[model samples]
Each structure stands twice: as structure tokens, then as C-alpha cells.
Target: MTERPSLKEMRAKALKNPEVKAEYDALASAFEMKRQMIALRKAAGLTQEEMAEKLGTKRSNISRLESMSASNSPSIATIENYARVLGYSLRVGFEPAAAR
Candidate 1:
């Protein structure tokens, strides 16, 4: 039997490609937002079901909103609502991008 490369190793190799890296960089902000959303929910000690109840939505809806691979992008209002339920206020800001 052959040993398989670890996911971290595979990811590092894949990210070495300029095209793949570019695509990954483009999606970084969305991934970071989803991560922060999940973190906030956990820190607030709320399960998806609890979050759904607070938001007046279904558990599945909460799951989709926190998913990185969700097909539809959530609206700003939806994000604001999510943050509000977690005792947070949504704040969007701009920063200079790294020189390409």
C-alpha cells in the first residue's frame, strides 16, 4: 500500500500554481468571513439550532449562511442580522491590496 500525501502537503503543492493561488486568494475573504461567523457563534455558546431560532430561520439556513461553499452569497442585511444575533455589529472596511 502506498502512503497518501497529507491534506496540508497537497494544499501547499496545489497553491504553488499561480492560477490556483490567484483563485484561492480571490475566495480568501469569503472563507475568512465564514470562519469568523462560526467562531462568533461558538463563542456566543449558540448551536446552529439556537442561532436559527434567534434569527427566526431554520437550522439549515443558519448552516448555509455559515458555509464556505454555499452557492448563494448572503446579502449585507443577512450578515448584519447574523452578527446582531451574536451580539456583534457588522463593520465593513477597505484596505490596500498587496502589490501583485
Candidate 2:
């Protein structure tokens, strides 16, 4: 009978896959977005439940979002929707960092 690969071996093999790398990057972005959203909500002085209700979502959804993982991520339209509900403007910009 063939033996199954160990967890360490499985991790090494997965990390070498391009698809895995891409997925990791995507998850990283999701985590960052979640952090920013939670910070904004707090700055606005709104509780997760309050924000979720204002955003037309459930409190659990807000909790998940604030916890650095909510959905794969809400769509851009969803994000705009949330911003609008929070009475804040959503701006998108791209600026490179200054040279060292």
C-alpha cells in the first residue's frame, strides 16, 4: 500500500505551484482590505453590528470582515455601496513610494 505524503511535504509542494502563489497574493489583499475596512468603521465610531446593518448586511458579516477574512471579498460595487451607507467617499488612486 502507498503511504500519504506528510504535512510538511504537502506544504512544500503547494508553495512551489504558481497557482498557489497567486491565491496567496489574493488572500493577502483580502486581509489588507479587511483591516482597512475595520479601521474605517472604528474611526466612524460605528459598531460592527451597526455598520453591518447600515451596510444592509448581517452583524456576522461585519464581524467576519473586521476579523481579516470576511468573504472572498465583496465586489467593488459592494464596497462602494458600503462607503455610501457609511456617508464616506470612496476614492481610488495609485502613487508610487518615494525613492530611498
By summed lDDT, the worst window of 10 consecutive residues in model 2 runs over 65-74
Q: How well is each residue in 1-100 modelled by candidate 2, as lDDT tens digits?
A: 9999999899789989989967766576557766777777888899988888787889987676566534365667777876777676677666564353
lDDT leader: 1
Query: What is the Cα-based TM-score of model 2?
Result: 0.54
Model number with the top TM-score: 1
Task: Return the TM-score for each candidate structure.
Answer: 0.93, 0.54
Which ranges of candidate 2 are over 4 A from the true structure? 1-26, 92-100
* Cα RMSDs, all models: 1.1, 7.2
Global fold similarity of model 1 (TM-score): 0.93
lDDT (Cα, tens digit) per residue for candidate 1, span 1-100: 9899999999999999999999999899999999999999999999999999999999999999999888999999999999998888999998899789
Candidate 2 C-alpha error for residue 10, in Å = 21
> Candidate 2, residue 5: CA error in Å?
29
lDDT of each: 0.95, 0.74
